[model samples]
Target: MFWHRATDYILSSNYMAHRFCYLLQPGLIWTNVVMDSLIAASYLLIFLALFWMSSRLRQVAEINRYVWIFVAFGTFIVACGMTHVMEVITLWWPIYRFSTVVKTICAAASVPTAILFVRIAPALTRNMERFIFMLSTTQQEKDRALTSLIASEKLAVAGRISASIAHEISNPLESVGNVLHLLRTGAGLSPEMQRLVDSAQGEIIRAGDIARSTLSLYRESAAPVEVSLVPLLQSIIDLQAPALVRNNIQIQTRMRATVAIRAYPGELRQVLINLIQNAAAAIGEDGKIFVRVQPRRGGYSITVADNGPGVQPADRTRLFSLFFTTKGEQGTGLGLWLAHSLIEKLGGRIKFRSRTAGEAAIRGTLFNIWLPLGTPPYVPLAPFSSVQAGRRQMQKTASVASR
Candidate 1:
C-alpha cells in the first residue's frame, strides 16, 4: 500500500508539472525536449517495475496470482495511455478539457490498481506459508526415500546370506526339539507326572513353532497385485486381533475413498503387520494405537500413531536401518527396515515423529505414510543399453574368478 501510494503521488506530480510547463511555453523547443525526456525516463522505470512484478507473479501457479497479474497489467496499460494523452494535450494542443479527462482516467485506473495490490497482500503471505510447508514435506520425503534405499541394500545382503543363516540355526533347533520330545515321552507312573509331561510337550511345540517362524524369514518373497487399500488394511487389523487385544492397542480407521493401488500385496500387508505389531508392543498393556486413512493434498495419508515410549533423537536416523533394534532379544531388527523398503517400492513414503514433553509424561510416536494418488508402477524394469548384458556378464565372471 505504501509503495502504491508513493508511485501514485510521484506519477501524478510529474504529470501535473509537465502539463503546466508545456502549456505555458509550447514554443520553446529545448524546454519541451528536456521535460519530455525526463517524463519518458520515468515512464520506462515504471514499466520496468511493472514487468518485474508481472514476472514474479508468473512464477506462482495459483489462480489468485494469475488474476492479480491480469488486473495489474490492465491497470498499467490504462495508466500509460492516460499519461501519453496528457503529454500530447499539454505539448501540442494546449486543451484544458483533454488534460482534465486524461487526469480523471489516470486517477480512476490508480484506484483499482491500488486496491488490487492490497487485496493480494494476504494471499502473498498465505502463499509463503504454503511454500514453506511444501518444502518441509519434500525434505521429509527425501529422507524417507534414502532410508528405504539403505534398507533395500541391507535386505539384498541379508537375502544373499539367508541360506547359510537358516542352515546354521536349523540343525541345532531340530536337535533340541528331538531331545525335548524324547525327554517328554520318558515313562513316569503317577497322574501328576503325566500332566507335567503333557505341559512340557506343549512348551516344546511352542518353541518349535517360534524357531520355524524365525527360519522362514529367508523364504519370504513379494509378488505384485492390485489390492483395494481399505479392505487390505482392515484385514491386517483382523490378523493382529490377538496381539492388539493382548496389548490393549485400539485400531481406528476410515477408508471410504476406496482407491485400489498397485503393490506387492503381501509385502504391503507385511509392512502394516510389522508396524501394527510394533505399535502394540511399544504400548505394552494400556496405550492406544490410532490408525487413520484419508485423502490429503491430492494424495492419501495413512497414519499409525501410538501412545508409547517414543524414539530418541539419536535413534531417529537409524530407525529403518538393518539390525537396528531396541527390543533386546525379542526383535530381529529388520521389521522397520523391511516395512520402509516395501512401502518405497510401492511408490509411497513413510515417516514418523517421536514427541515427548518431559520424563513425567508418556511419549508417543506417529508413523505416517503418504501414498500418491493414482496407480503405482508394479514392474521395475532396468533401462536398456547396448552394452548392458555384456557388461553384466563380464562383471559376473570377474567376480567369480576373483573369488
Candidate 2:
C-alpha cells in the first residue's frame, strides 16, 4: 500500500508540472502535454476525494462545518494552481501568451483564503477566551459551595458556646437593672450606699460588655443603620487593638472620604474586622498594615494590605476558592470567601492582589472592597416599648459619641 501511494505521488507531481507548461499556450496540443494535463486533473480530483472524506469525518464526529468548508475550498484552489504550474513547466519550455493571465487569476483566488484566516483567527480567540472564563467561573462556584458546607459545620460547633454566652448576658443584665433601680428610687438607701451602688453599677456594666462581646460574634444579622465611616472604623480598630498589638502588626489608617452610607453598620464592621485580622495574621511580627478608604466612582473603596509573607504563586489563583487555604491547618479559608459574598450582596465588589516577589515582603496581599453609594440600610424588628426604643437609639448615639 505504501509503494502504491508513493508511485501515485510521483505521477501526480509530473502531471502537475506538465499542466504548468500547457497554460502557457491556448491551442498547443502536445500529446504529452494533453496526457499530463489529464493526469494532473485526475490527481487534483484525489484532493477533492480527501476533501469529501474530511466532510464525512466532520459529520460523524460533529466537527464544525465552517472549518470543513475552509479546508475544502482552500485545498481545491491550491490544487488547481499546482496543476496549472505543472503544465507551464513540463509541457512547454518557454513562456506562452496565457502564462501571466494564469498567475493573475491564481493571485486573485489566494486573497479570499488569506482574508479568511485573519478574520477566523480573532473569532477563534474570542470563543476560546469565553470558554475558559466560563470554566473558571464554574470551578469558583463549586469551591464556594464546598466552603459554605464546611463553615456551616463550624457554626454548628460554635452554636453550643453561643447558648452559654446568651445566658451569661441575661443574668448580669437583670442584676444591673435591679441595682440601677435601687439607686434611682433610693427606697431606704443611705448616702454611702449611693457610692457603693455606683461602683457596683460600673462592674455590672463591665460584665454586660463582656457578654455583649461574646454574643456579638454570632449576630443573626447586623441591623442596618445610617452610619458614618469614621466612627465605625475607629470602633473596629479599638476592638481589634489588643490583637493588633499582640501580633506586633501596626495599622496605619488613612481616610480620604467622609461618607455616610446606608448599611448594616455591624455587618460592615464585621467585614472590616475579618479583613484586618487576616491582614495582621499574614504578617508575623514587626509587620505593617495599611487600611485606606477613598471615594470611588459611585461608591467607596476600602483596601486592607499587610507587609507579611504574601500568597504563593500557585495559590493566588485559588485564593477565593472555598477551603483552599494558604495558611494550611491554621486557616479556615472561608473568611475571605464569606467576606466576598457579604460585600457582593451589599452591592459591593471585593478584589485582591498578591505579590511574592520584591523587597519588604512585597509578598503581601492587597484586598480592595468597593461599596456603592446609596445602599439601603438594614431594618431590625421593632422594639416592644417606645421607652425601650428610645433607649436603644440613645445607646447608639452614645456609642457613636464615645468613638
Off by over 4 Å in 2: 1-150, 153-167, 173-210, 220-223, 357-363, 376-403
- Where model 1 places Cα greater than 4 Å from the true spot, the runs are 1-224, 357-362, 377-403
What does candidate 2's lDDT look like per residue over 1-403, in tens digits?
9989755554443223344545745566566556656766775777677677676666643345455545746564655656565464645343333444455666666676677767777877787699799999999899867867777667545643563566567696877769696775767778788777887777676566556654554543434556687777776776778777987779899987676877766457668888888888788778998988889998788888987788777777877766667777998777776677668767788999888765343468899998877764334332123334555798999999999
Tens-digit lDDT track of model 1 for 74-120:
56665665565456545544455556666777778777777877887
* lDDT (Cα) of model 2: 0.68
| lDDT assessment of candidate 1 | 0.68
Clashes of each: 0, 17
Q: Given candidate 1, what's the lDDT at residue 183?
A: 63
lDDT (C-alpha) at residue 90 in model 1: 58
Lowest-sum lDDT 10-residue window in model 1:
379-388
